[model samples]
Target: MIHRLFRHIDAGTTSYTDETGANPVSSYTCADRLDRERRTLFRDTPLLVGFSGRVAKAGDYVVEEIDGRSILITRDREGAVHAFHNVCSHRAAPVAQGSGNARRFVCPYHAWTYGLDGTLQSIPDGRSFDGVCKSAHGLSEIPSAEKHGLIFIRPGGGDPIDVDRHLAGLERDMAAYGFDRFHHYRSLTIERQMNWKLCPETFMEGYHLQYLHRESVGPIFFSNLMAFDSFGPHTRLTLPRRRIMELRDRPEEDWRLIPETAIIYNFFPNVTMVVQAGHVEMWRSYPSGDATDRCKVQVSVFTPEAVETEKARKYYEKNIDLAIRTVDGEDFPLSEAIQSGHAARAHETLIYGRNEPALTHFHASLNGALGA
Candidate 1:
C-alpha cells in the first residue's frame, strides 16, 4: 500500500531486524508446548473464517470448522451477522449441515429447528417432554463480527468477540482493499499430516520462494528481498515485483499497490492473506483435533471482479491448481519431511536467519501468546 510504502521510505529502509540470531526448537516439536499453543493462542483468539461475500445476502450463511468447533455463521433478514455453535440445542446434533440460503436450520437428528437469528423455533413433538422449556435453549451463541468484508469468530464460544481490538491498527490498512466487495471464487479443504504452525510459516518468507517455487511463481516475484512490518502479532510482508521500480517516476495518484507486488498479511496464529491485483487468497489452518501432528487448511480465493467468461474461469481454475502444486507439491511435502525429524531425536534447535525476520517475529508472537 502507498501508506506502507511511504512509511518504509520515511524510515529509509524496508524493515528492520536484529542481526543477533536465536534457536527455537521446543516450540516447534514439543507436543505439550504445541497443545498449550492450541489452547491459549489459537482457540482463545478470534479467527478470520470467511469473507463477507460468503454470506452476502440476508439469508446467506456459512458453516466452518475452527479448531474442531463447528461454527455456524449467518446473516439475518435485518442484514446483521450472527454466529453460533453448529450443534442443535437438543441432543447436541448439528443444526446446520453445509452452507446455503435457509430461513431455518433443521437438525437431521430430530427435526429441531432454529431461526437465522439463532432462536429456537419449533420441536417435532412438543408433548414428548413433560417439563421442557423451548425458549430456554437456543443454539449456543459465539462472538462474531463482520467488518472490511471479512467474518471473524472466537471458537471458544464466549461472549461478543471483539474482532476489531484483535487487529491492533492493522484494520485501517486492511480496510483499504474493500474485501467485502470481493467475490468468493473457489475453495479447497484438504487434510495433511503436518503441524499447523509449520504450514503457515511456509508462506511468511521469500527465502524459499526462489528455491521452492522457482518453477512456478518464483520468477514472477522478486525473491529474497522483502519489506516487513509488525503490528501486534500480525505481519505485513511485501514481495515487490521487479517492475515496482517503475512507480518511482510515476505520479503518486497514478500508482497501484497491487500486481506490482505480492503483499502478504500474516494474521497471527492461523489466517494468512495474499493480496494481488485481480484477487485475494485467504488460507486458514485449523488444528485437526487434539492431534498436534495433524492439521487442515481451508483455502478460499476471492476475486474483485466476476469470472464471467469461460477463459477467466479456466484461468482461476488453473491458478488454484498451480497454487496447490506449489504448496502441496513442493512446500508441504518438505514440511512433512521436516516434521518427521522432530521425532527422530536429532536436531535440538533450529536457527532463524536475520533475513527471515517475519518468521522470527511470528514465532516470538506465538511464544508470547502461549505465555512462554
Candidate 2:
C-alpha cells in the first residue's frame, strides 16, 4: 500500500473510480430515507459499538444510546462479552446508565436487578404478579460479538454476529493493529447540525485536505492522493503523508505503513476507524432524533498502551485536543453550511468526483442497503 501511495505521489495521480457519481439530495434531507436507514443499516446490521478494552474486566459495562436506542454492553466473569437493550424487563426502565464496574445493574426506577450476563436476578418484591417468569424476563439481548478487538451489536437483535462475515476480508488488516490491547484515552460527543452520513463523509476523502484544511492538517499530507480498496460494502483508504516521499530513499524492508500515513477503514453505514502514527481514533455518528438535519458524533482516541503516568495522560490528551480542534473547528463548519444548502434547495443532487471514490462507494452502498 505504501509503495502504491509513493507511486501516486511521484506521478501526481490518485486512485479514481470509473466515473463520477451522483446521489439525490433527499438521501440526506428526507426523513423517510433516514428512517429506512435506521432500520436496515443501524438496527439490522452489526454496528461497531466500541472497543474490547473498554470492558476489559468482569462486571465492566458501558451504556450507549445510538440513533435513539439505548444499548448495554457488558463483560461477564467468564470473560465473555454481551449486549442488551438496556431496558429493564419491569416497566421498561434503563437498567444501566453511563459506564463503570458493577456486579449487578439495578434499575433506578424500581430496583429490578440484573446480572452481568443480563439475566434478571431478582425483583424488588417477588410475587407481585401471578406467574411472571424471571428466566423469560431477562434484558432483551441484542445480537453481539467481539472481534479483532472491537465490539459490535445489532440493536434490533437477530442471529449471532459472524465477525469474519461481517467484516468480510478486512479482519486481517484490523488484527494487525492489535486494537484489543489499545487503551482508551478520551472521548468527546459533539452535536452537529448536519445529517449523520455527512459526518463520516468528511473523513472519507483526501480531496479536500489541501483546500479545506490547508492551514490545519493539509500541509502534512499529500493532496488528492490515496490508496483505496473495497471489502464488501466497506472501504479502506491509505492516505500518504507528504513525508512519505522520504521512504523512496530508504530500503523497502524498512517501510512501515502504519506510522508513515493514516489508514482509514470506513465500515459500512456509520463507523470510521482511523489508525494514526501513535494512536487510533474511532468516530461514531448517529441521527440526533427523528430529524434528518441533525446528528451527534462521538470521537474517541486510544493509545497503544495504557497510560500509567500523568505525563503520558497529558500527551494523549493533547493529541485528542488537536484532533477535536481540526475537525470541530475546521471541517464541521463547512459541513453545517452544506447541510444548510440542502435545505435551501440549491441543488437536487450532490456529485461525487472520481477522485473521491470512498464517498462514492459509501453512498452507493448506503443506497443499496436502504433499497434492500
Candidate 3:
C-alpha cells in the first residue's frame, strides 16, 4: 500500500506521464535544462544566495557565483545592499577577488575603477576616448534584496519580484525558528559529482536514514516522516524524534521541547534548508556543467549565548564539522554514483518511495517549470 502511494506521488503531472501508462521521471539529462537554468533561472530570476549577517557593515562584501556568473555582493555607503556582475566594464576583467571589505572595485586589466554603487568612477586617460561615456560604461547592476536576514540576487537584468512576496510561507517558518535573531558563524562548501537535484532529493526524505546514516544520525531521528504543505514550489518536511528521552513521550502539545525536531525546506530548483534542534544549515546546488553539479552547503550554528561563551562557540563548531564531514564523506558519494547510473540509461525512470514525498514534489515542480 505504501509503495502504491509512492507511485501515485511520483507519477507527477500529465505532461510527464509516459505512453506506457507508467510514471515518467523528468529528464534532467538534457543540456537544455542546464542551459535554461543558467540563462533564465540563475541569471534572470531572483535566487536566494546567503544570509545578511555576513555583510552587515557598509564596506563588507562577499564574492559568490550564481548560475556560473561571478557576483560581487556589497553594501553601499548608505548601507543598502547591492549586487554587481563581478566582470569589469573595461576588458571584461574580474573586478574583485574573494570577498572582503572594499571601498571600491578596480579592474586590473585596464585600471578601470567602479564605486560600490556600481558607478564607473575612473578610466585610464579619460581624454583619449572622446565619445566614451562613464555613465553608460558602469558595471552591470544585478538586482538584490534582503529579507528575513537572507540575501537574494536576480541575475537576469530586470526589475525583481518582492522578496517578501516570493518567500510568503517561508517567512513564517523562519520566524518561528527565530531566524531573524540567528547569527552566522561559518560556511563550508562541498563539491559533489552528481546532478544538482540529487543533493536536495537525498536530504528531503528520512527513509534513507535507517540504512545510510544508521550508525551516526539514525539514532536521533525517526524514519517515519510527515510533510508540511508545499509553499509555492518549495516543500517542508517534519522529522519526528526517535530515542531522545526529552522528546520521546511528550504529547503533541509539548512539541516545544524541540519545536518540530527537524524541518527540511526545499526552495525550488536547487536550494534547501535543514533546521535542526540547535542550528540551521542551508544547501545551494549549482550545476557545474552539463554533467556535474557543485553544491555549497553552509552550516549556520545559532544560539543567543553563542557569542557570550567560548565553549558554546567551540561546541557548535564541532557539531557543524561532524555534520558536514558525515554528509560529504558518506551521503554525497552515494548520490554521485546514483546520478551517473541514471544518466547511463536514457529511458529508465527513477522511483520515489512512499515516505519520499518531498522528492515527488520536486520532480513534479521541475516538469512544470520545463513544460515537459
Best-fitting candidate, measured by lDDT?
A: 2
Instruction: Write out the backbone clash pairs for model 1.
Output: 149-180
- TM-scores for all candidates: the values are 0.93, 0.97, 0.85
CA lDDT scores, all candidates in order: 0.81, 0.87, 0.69
Candidate 3 residue 160 Cα shift, in angstroms, is 1.6
Off by over 4 Å in 2: none
- Kindly give the stretch of ten consecutive residues in candidate 2 with the minimal lDDT sum: 315-324
What is the C-alpha lDDT profile of model 1 across 1-372, one tens digit per residue? 665655554454545577745655556567788788778866678888888988889888888887888889999999999988898888998888678899888899999889999998898888996477877888888888888888887777565666668888898876888888888887788788878887788888877787888898888766666788889999988877767767879888888878688888888778889887767888888877777678899888898877789999988778677777788889888888777776564778777777788888988888788778
lDDT of 3 by residue, 27-102 (tens): 5565676676666555655677766766767888877765567888888899889988898886788998777788
Model 2 score (lDDT): 0.87
Candidate scoring better on TM-score of 1 and 3: 1
C-alpha lDDT (0 to 100) for residue 79 of candidate 2? 89
TM-score of 2: 0.97
**Best-fitting candidate, scored by TM-score:** 2
Q: Could you arrange the candidates by lDDT from highest to lowest?
A: 2, 1, 3
